[model samples]
Target: MNFSSKLLENAVAEFARLPGVGQKTALRLVLHLLNQNKQEVEQFSHAITKLRNEIQFCTRCHNISDTSICEICSSHKRDASVICVVEDTRDVMAIENTSQFNGLYHVLGGLISPMDGIGPSDLQVDSLVERLKDGEVREVIFALSATMEGDTTIFYLHKKLKHFNINISTIARGIAFGGELEYVDEITLGRSIVTRVPYENSLTK
Candidate 1:
């Protein structure tokens, strides 16, 4: 952890602060960047600066964007009436990569975790309720992860949206297509069987 130069030490410290990055990894990254041409390093620094300074969040879904409204929200081809409720913009990106969902998204900003001091009020819950009250979205699909926090958030949202006319749904949680039944967890295998779809319905998709 001892760097010959204070500048290198500072850079390594900053890099180490990033998630999943250890001190050794940070030191390696800093060394790698140090070996790069001055112009390339300047460009790298400028790009980071630009991302922090110029990034905007979508007014509708709270997704990261370069404008007030994200491209997906503004797209005419997407189904605005069906909103996919997710934990954050990363979920949006993951779903978008699938090319399977053609619906709009509602980023909750973060999940409800009382232990972490994050409550429903800390998220975009009010805005989502308002969106539902506006009577535009007909179907709301919950696409949260299968964790305790994710489940808690979904339950809270379900209660808040129970009276709404929108059709409530959740992304199917089960074993992967190629996964073996023996290797799958008991809860997942049980849920998969309980939510098993008709063979004909599965074939169509």
Candidate 2:
């Protein structure tokens, strides 16, 4: 197969770099983009560029935001005393879609995966501990995945935060094993929050 166009190859290569996109899918996407009108292509490129340039991480919750603090963190309607800790901004969006949690959030950025070399220090765990120093927070709800890495991170956090009297809880197992909060149904996610268990007693009988 003789490759003719460098531009098309570059576009396919770029698309392939995205997570879960294979060479075939990347080629298909590039062809689809090529079929679109010039104005549509320009708009797509502009949107991608704008997302990279305008969006930033919220200094407080570590969620993607246009400002230092996200709108959720600045909202007076949310309960500042309770923080729902999630693995990523996607999880935060998933929980927000349920509208069941009225508290603030803390995005850990990622989980502790030893095989992937992602340790507790690699995440925003220290920031969470610092946030608790104010004593305004009464609860930290762990909404991480149910995988082994997730369990390990939660246990580490529990031990680190044991000195604080605040309640530490984990979302109920309504979410199946290996289930990601981003993919769980809204009703199941809401139910999980309603039936969350105390983290301290999770390992106990």
Candidate 3:
């Protein structure tokens, strides 16, 4: 797209780099920002800058946080012995919104997708195993999407964690095949968590 100002073009280009954003949408966003008052624009820019510079990942669960540890990991009210394993931070937020789970979480960062070249090593698999080694955890709930990649990741995790004397389960299949937790309705997602099944049982189906 042609632009009268190089600065406006550059701003649009940067915005277009974001996922799901096209050049037109980016340009519209840039134009909208240009219409905003100077103070509002500066505040918006400062907030994004500060977020990028100051956000931290929780060392324990790999969740994005303002501090080294996420509030969920440090909360005394949560069930420390029960850990829900999810594909990413978005899944954590989805589950939290349901208020069905009262346990800690271990974000895998990403699912094991062979086609995408994402393997167990590419994820936070080692850290999850290390967390289990201490034996404070007695149950591990798999709250991944119902896609092939999600199943593969859960299978790999189950193999790695089976030796531990803990209950290994997957959220019940209330979610349709290929459905992501982040997209499922809150009632369905919450019911799935409440009615989880053993990993081995799911294998038979």
Candidate 4:
């Protein structure tokens, strides 16, 4: 089979490196981009470069932002006493789109998965504990996934914050098993927030 230029192959390989994008899709995308005008391609390249160079994670919430703190953390209209803990910035965006939660958020960056070599210490858990130390927070809502790794992270966080006076809760099981927050619809996400329940240990009773 006749092969394309090395430049086209390189672009396809780079696109394939993105999450969930396979080689075929990557090749198709590269071909589409190659068909575009030079000016358009230049604009696309510039935009992607700017995204990497200009964006930064918020120091407070760990969400991707242009500044040190994300807009949600810096906004005065949000409820400072309530904090929702999410697995990543995507979950934060999902919850924000629902418009059901008005509180701030703490992004763990990932769940506790021993198989993946990601533990509590690897996440932003210590920052969460530090934030709770002030005693200003009234409630903490966990918006993590329903997977075992997510459950383990939740329990670890609960144990760590048990001594605190704040109420700890988890979003309702409206999210289906193995469902990712990024794929859940806004209605289900909003309902989950509205029907959140307190975390409790049945064995302790």
Candidate 5:
């Protein structure tokens, strides 16, 4: 697409770099922002800049946060003994929306995808093991997506965690194979969480 101004072209290009955004959508966004007041545009830019500069990952669960610890990790109302393991902050948000779980969460930065060169070392696996060492946790729920990578990650995690006294479980197959937790409906996700089965049980299926 051609833009009359280099500045507008640059802006649209940057916006188009975002996932799922095409050149046309980015151009539309840039035009919309251009239509906004100077103060509003500044505010928009400032918010993005501040987020990139100041956003912190929770020290405990690695969820995105303003402080060292996220509100979910710091909350007394959440079940400290049950930690729901998810792929990222987006999955955490998806699970939270269901209100089916009242537990803490551990966000693995990503799954163990050998094809993508991501392994256990690249994820937050070590910190999770450290969390279990304190003996405060009783159950660890594998809430990863139903993809091959997700299964591989969970299998690796199960091997590392089976020695622990805690119960290891995976969400039920209410979610179809290759389904991502973030894309599933809230009711189905909630039921899956509620009906989670033993990690070993899942292996036999």
Candidate 6:
């Protein structure tokens, strides 16, 4: 698509680069921002810049944070004995929104998708193993999406952690196969977490 102004074209291009954003939507967003006051636009730009520059990943869980460790990881109130393993920060947000889980999280960053050239080494799997070595965590909950890639990731992790004498479980199949946790209804996701099944049982199906 052609724009009369090069500035408008550039803004639209940048917006379109984001996932799920099309050229038309990008154009609309750029036009909307053009209608806003200069100060408001500057504020928007500054906010994005500040977020990119200041955001830090939690050293322990790999979740996005303002500090080296996230509030959830550092919280004394959270159950340190249980760790819910998820694919990314978005899944963390989804689970947190349900308020059903009081335990901490381990964000793997991404799953084991060999077709996409993502393997165990591509994830934070080694860090998770290190976390389990001390016998502090009693349970590891696989709260990843109910997809094939999710299953592959879970299986690989279970194999790595099996020797630790810790309980290993996965969120109930209340979530549809291929359904992302972030998109599942909160009620279903909450129920799944509350009624999880053993990792061994997950292998049967």
Residue by residue across 10-119, what tens digits does model 3's lDDT show?
Answer: 99999999999999999989999999999999999999999999889999999999888899999999999999999989999999998989999999999999899988
Candidate 2 lDDT by residue in tens digits, 3-65: 479988898999999999998899999999999999999999999999998889999999999
Clashing pairs in 5: none
Say which prediction, candidate 3 or candidate 5, comes out ahead on lDDT. Answer: 5
Error of 2 at 67 (Å): 1.5
Shift of residue 158 alpha carbon in model 3, Å: 0.9
Instruction: Tell me how far candidate 3 lies from the true structure as C-alpha RMSD in angstroms.
Output: 6.9
Q: Per-prediction TM-score, please?
A: 0.96, 0.82, 0.83, 0.82, 0.83, 0.84
Whole-model lDDT, candidate 2? 0.91
In model 1, the worst 10-residue window by lDDT is 196-205
Worst ten in a row by lDDT for model 4: 196-205
Q: Name the weakest run of 10 consecutive residues (lDDT summed) in model 5.
A: 196-205
Clash number for model 2? 0
| CA-lDDT, candidates in order | 0.93, 0.91, 0.93, 0.90, 0.93, 0.93
lDDT, residue 104, candidate 1:
96
Residue by residue across 3-70, what tens digits does model 4's lDDT show? 46888778888999999999899988988998999999999999999999888999988998898988
Model 6 CA lDDT for position 155: 91
Clashes of each: 0, 0, 0, 0, 0, 0
**Candidate 6 to native Cα RMSD, angstroms:** 6.9
lDDT of 5: 0.93
Q: How displaced is residue 117 in candidate 2, in Å?
A: 1.2
The model with the greatest TM-score is 1
Model 1: how far residue 30 lies from native, Å: 0.5
Against the true structure, candidate 6 reaches a TM-score of 0.84
The better-scoring model by lDDT among 1 and 4 is 1
